[model samples]
Target: MEQSTTIEIKDNSFARQFETIIPEGLLTVEYSFQERKIFLTKINTPDEFQDEIFLDNLIRTILDNAIEQRLKVVPTYPRIVQFFKKNPQYKELLPPGIRI
Candidate 1:
């Protein structure tokens, strides 16, 4: 059987964002209660691990994290937005009235 990947998410209140770390990279995203939106501010991935499937799974993991926290997000990266746009099943991950 294949082992499931483990992605860790840590809330850094000092930075007002969640820090997600996967074997291939790290992503920093900020959540604003007043704005009710999560902002993906930064991403760093090793070139060797930049496969589309890996990236899609990474983004899905992030969105799942946000859902578990009961928050909507505004993905700033064009790639992320495009990915969500292409995948309608993940539409609920977007903030209301906000289209990618």
Candidate 2:
């Protein structure tokens, strides 16, 4: 029998961050509101689960959450830019005017 993989994403209001939890571990993306800018800080994903497919899906999920909350995001992590650079198809998931 094949076991289903359950990935859960949550917004931690007190911490001002978004969290994605899976069997491997937790992934966190922090954000802050400054005037018209929404600063999306570090993205911490489990080292073991940093494969391309996983990273792509995870990033997409985070971006979707941000849109649902009507928040503009500025992804500060270099990896995010790298991911989009390598897979331009996913660039549509990003909001307008995001540097990366």
Candidate 3:
């Protein structure tokens, strides 16, 4: 199904997470920072909201933010690592000499 709704993500830096509120519930991408690298540690999505389009939009927003901030991404979460594997274009955001 086509997702007509725009995915809006809020970066709660104090909580070290990116959050979005949907009808289903709150979704979040938890993370930590070490120098230029942001370690994406976990992704929490409500069961009802766990669909491919929603997840991809969420991840894409995070990647876009990381790009704007010029921060290297370190996908510590297995799901995010898998995402980078599938979306090779995002691999350039990874720290040099690192592989998914």
Top candidate by TM-score: 3
- Candidate 3 on 46-84: residue-level lDDT in tens? 887757777877888899889999999999899899889
Per residue, candidate 2 scores C-alpha lDDT tens digits across 1-100 of 2232334768797998778776678878777876544566777778777555665666667666656776665656787777667756555545676545
**TM-score, prediction 3:** 0.89
- Estimate candidate 3's alpha-carbon lDDT, on a 0 to 1 scale: 0.88
Write the candidate numbers in order of decreasing TM-score: 3, 1, 2
lDDT of each: 0.69, 0.67, 0.88
lDDT of candidate 1 over 1-100, digit per residue (tens): 2233665668787877667665666655554444666777555565655566656666777788778888777777777787789777778877778876
Error of 3 at 48 (Å): 2.9
lDDT of 1: 0.69
Better of 1 and 2 by lDDT: 1
Candidate 3, residue 97: how far the Cα is off, in Å: 2.2
The weakest ten consecutive residues by lDDT in model 1 span 1-10
Candidate 1 vs candidate 3: the TM-score winner is: 3
Q: Residue 55 CA error for candidate 2 (Å)?
A: 2.0
What is the Cα root-mean-square deviation between model 3 and the actual structure? 2.2
